[model samples]
Target: MANSDMCNSVGASPGAIQAPPLPAFQPRSCFACRRRKVRCDRQSPCMSCTRNITDCVFPAPGRATRHGSTSAQTPKRKQAHLLSRLQRLESVVEILAAQVKGPAESGTLELDGAGLVGQGIGKEGRGSALDDKTARLGEELGLLVIDENGSVYIGNQFWAAFRDEINQIKQVFDNDDRQGDIYSAETSSLNGSIPSDLTRQRREDSLLFLFWQSRGQDVPLKDLHAFPSQLPIIWQIYIENVDHYSKMLHVPTFAKRIQDLQGDFSRMTPGMEALMFAITMSAINSMSNEDVKIKLHAEKSDLVARYRTGTEIALTLADFINTTELDVIQAFSIFLDTVQTMESPKYVWSVAGLLARVAVSAGLHRDGSNFPGMSPFNIEMRRRLWWNILFIDGRSGSDQIAEASLHEEMFDTKLPTNVNDTDLDPSMKVPPITRNAITDTTPILVRSEL
Candidate 1:
């Protein structure tokens, strides 16, 4: 009885000792109250949650404490959003990869027989809604630059850097190494399907015959010296306006070639005339001011007329597929860029492909070392012409057409030396050959890298 009395008396004073302060009632609100920012009413189920008929649960039961506050939840929400965007980006990449690797898989893509002008491969308006959103995301994420006109320009440097980061993310979703095999199969399928011998020969013969018939035998040769007075203006316009667009011709070399002709217009080959006219036309067409273009077009109407005429004459005179003249290739290359007869970009692309085919026919893809007694000057000129064709093909041909007639692996021509034309005087003991690294600075190194 004494022990029982002692135990009972020890805790007897604590019976009404404030019930341990009721956990201090620091307002640990329900989820609905916190999210909606309403008053919690300090109940087990808050007034806001009960009124909204929600679960009335707290995300963090001790959310009244600093560690469980809004500040602590912000980073988690942000992380979730970032994760969602990354997943979307991966989905876009997979679609594009499928398109590139296997065209048949891209059901939305409509391809022509030539496979040059496909609807969805690189063109707008044919992509899926997801693709459109991905393109918008590209702008938001800085993969593409959007101008005020809404034109998108892919930044190669940014792409190279971002590609590495995206590739890391790709590993999380895609583990298949079969993409390489798929791409290789696509390429082989393109290359493996060869025309029959008769078909190939017929095609070659037709192209040759077209060149043969284009030459108007009864047409009189237009005297180039008749316009010697206008030549200075043409040269000036070419240097100022057109040369930057395509740096295929060297001024000093052209000047030397002209001097060697000794002012005799009759001595100029048909190919040379075509080249001159093409340059003149390009300079006239590329005038920046609208008024100036109109005035120049009216004043140079004769010159404009001669551009097509001269190109036709050159093509007529040359043996075409059988001819191996570097000037013929050069003339056609500039002509492709200068011709305004066709407004479609695909026209220029197809013409550029034709020029590439002619170049390959001339063995320009091979090193000059294989040719016995080939001059260093001729070798350099071949290198220049080949690289220029590649540049044109890549820029004008691939960008719009999405098909390349010339493949880099099929060619082994070395890049021309980066020296200026005067420095490369071939007459002076075959000007000393100096090699540049593939990555070295050059006025036209993009084609070489490609």
Candidate 2:
């Protein structure tokens, strides 16, 4: 009857659900620690195991795991091991957090592999800013840097000249859409043939058509000086760096003429046009890519390409080879100077020889003192040119890995007067006597002396 009662009780719970299978236990303590009832550092051979000189083994997961099983560690030892693992996990998480959050919150950008990154701007926001506003627009340590807000920063060498006006000039940037994109033809096959000349009907405007004739195509006149607004920005860069060093242009008069004719390109002589393009090209060449981005908000390579093409077109229009024009030669000189470092030595050598030939033909090699009819002002300008040509020739030779194109006896042009710009007026009769110790002219004087 008792056996019958027990059977009835066992059958009574037949409808009840069975318990889920127990998961395997992953042991944290090494075999040595488990045997000695001690903690394990969980290293390949734990510290305690190392000191005791015993075999260290980790427990592997298995299907035989059970809370009631007597084959493994006591509950207290298992709990201690679990606690140690939790602490290690927490510490790793903390180390990861520290690595993610460095001190400064400012955004920064790194461009190219040159390591020239721009410092980022502040990230603080206004009342309307989103909660996730900490994200940056762009950040880099470039030659020039801009932040999310579009504030620009350039190097001191360039900024000193135009820092006062670059902000207001952003209004001019709105008109950037007006400028046409310069297209570069990418061809798979070689096309060496030149396009035929413009029609006779189109050639009615001979001078205008002449500019395109030598360029070997029918080009729009409006395309000649594309960005008129950027004239001030680039002109300032040229005057500050190149003109200050070269002393080629008479700043007092030349600056005035440029300002007057700036609004009217049709009134500009081809020689002057060439000079403008060459100056702007050199101005760009003097700057880093970053500086171009901040000031012009354009790529350095693009600006150089456009202005260089313009220079070639303008020089062709001026008939630079056959002309006795000072502006054309001066333009040639400036263009050569700008390209000396940027172009291949072989190419620069060829251009340098071309400049030397034009300069010699213009009598720039002879001393101004040899001419009786020339004014002191003309003499001074000629002296500057003569010496500059020689300098260019010497540099060109160095580019070609050779000596100067001309010997000492070839030209006797004296060094330019050390007088200030104020001293040499076209209306002046006698030359200024005393040379100023410090003037804008002072630099070119030192260069000539060298």
Candidate with the greatest TM-score versus the true structure: 2
- Candidate 2: lDDT over CA atoms? 0.60
Worst 10 residues of 1 by lDDT: 178-187
lDDT by residue (tens digit), candidate 1, 106-222: 223223332222222222333455445444423222111112211122222334434434543343233132111000012222333465666554554455443332344444546
Model 1 clashing residue pairs (backbone): none
Q: lDDT per residue, candidate 2, 1-450, as tens digits?
A: 999998778768878666553223222445676577554555666788789888877655332344444364444644454455446446534532332222254333333333223333333432346233222222211122212211112322322222213322232233233321111121111122222244323333343332232345445534856477888888889888788888887878777888898578888887888888888889998989999999999899888877776776677667676556778888888888887776677777776887887776665765443333346887788777767777777766864656547666555456787877777887777766656587756776777666
Error of 2 at 377 (Å): 1.3
Give the distance in Å from residue 40's predicted Cα in candidate 1 to where it truly belongs: 99
How many clashing pairs in candidate 2? 10
lDDT scores of the candidates, listed in order:
0.52, 0.60
Off by over 4 Å in 2: 1-221, 399-404
